[model samples]
Each structure stands twice: as C-alpha cells, then as structure tokens.
Target: MTHAFYVYASYGFAALVTIVVTVWTWADGRARRRELAALEAAGIRRRSARPKDSLGDGE
Candidate 1:
C-alpha cells in the first residue's frame, strides 16, 4: 500500500509520454501533408528529396 506514490507517478508519466508522442506524430504528419499539398499546388511536382535519389542526397 505504501508504494501508491510510485505507482501513481508511473501512470502519470506514461500518460504524459503517450500524449506527447501522439501529438508529435500527428503534427509532423499534418505538416508534411500540408507542405506537400502546397508544393503540388505551386507546381513543384517534386519533393525536395526525389524518390529516385538516395537518402544521402539530402532531405
């Protein structure tokens, strides 16, 4: 019964990390999609990193 503090803290920390990663991934995907859409609308027709090019080319 005396370990309730640790248990509560662990649960709180787990929730915080979960919330953080969820938000981070969501924001990242949304931003990338928006940028891609804008680029398409602007007629770039290509991502900064072309699929044909290797990752070493640059992001």
Candidate 2:
C-alpha cells in the first residue's frame, strides 16, 4: 500500500527476471556446445572451422 513497498516489489521482480534469463542463457549455451560436439564427432563441421586455404578461394 506504500510507495516503498511498490518500489521494493518492482526491484525484486526485476532481479528475479534477470537471474532466470542468465541461467537460461547459460544452460542453452552448454546444450548448444554439446550439440556442436556431437555434430563434429559425426564428421560435420562448421564452414568457418575449415582451413581458409581449403576453401579454394585462390589463396
């Protein structure tokens, strides 16, 4: 019912959102890395990972 209560509640909600997003991003990155590793193990590679000379761009 007071201004201070509203402010504190808003700040708490923002903090909670920030922490959730941070954890979600971290977990997604780990999952993507694992997927990339699996793909590499299956003989798939990112084009950028190839040697520049192998691209045959007349280096």
Candidate 3:
C-alpha cells in the first residue's frame, strides 16, 4: 500500500468519527430537552430557575 492511501484512509476515518459524534451529541441534547420539558410539566423545577429570594441567600 502507498503512503497516500494510508493518509487518506486515516483522514476519512477521523472525519467519519467526528460526524458520528456530532450527530450523537445533537440527538442526546434533544432527548434531554424533551425529558426536561416533561418533568417541568409535571411541576418539577430546577433550582437555578427559582428566584434568588426563594433560595434564602443573604444579599
């Protein structure tokens, strides 16, 4: 096998891996958002979403 073949194959594999990871991350984010929405609809809330006054933090 030639050096050029190896280099191109390596680059192709790297690009394929990058694309796969990007797609997976995007999909996972969408799923998480959906779950969060469902939880919010069920009256569960995130602490960060609450008003600071409700947290009893000293000003």
TM-score computed on alpha carbons, candidate 3: 0.89
The local lDDT score (0 to 100) that residue 52 gets in candidate 3 is 68
Off by over 4 Å in 3: 57-59
Q: Which model is ahead, 2 or 3, in terms of TM-score? A: 3
Candidate 3 — what's its lDDT?
0.95
Residue range 1-59, candidate 1, lDDT tens digits: 56998999999999999999999999999999999999889888765456665656655
Local accuracy of candidate 3 as per-residue lDDT tens digits, 1-59: 99999999999999999999999999999999999999999999998899867877653
- Sorted on TM-score, best first, the list reads 3, 2, 1
Error of 3 at 14 (Å): 0.4
Error of 3 at 10 (Å): 0.3
Looking at model 3, the pairs that clash are: none
**Candidate 2 has which clashing residue pairs, if any?**
none
lDDT (Cα) of model 1: 0.87
- When summed lDDT is taken over every stretch of 10 residues in candidate 1, the lowest stretch is 47-56
Lowest lDDT sum, 10 consecutive residues, model 3, at: 50-59
Write down the lDDT of every candidate, Cα atoms only: 0.87, 0.96, 0.95
- The CA lDDT at 35 in model 3 is 100
**Ranking 1 against 2 by TM-score, winner:** 2
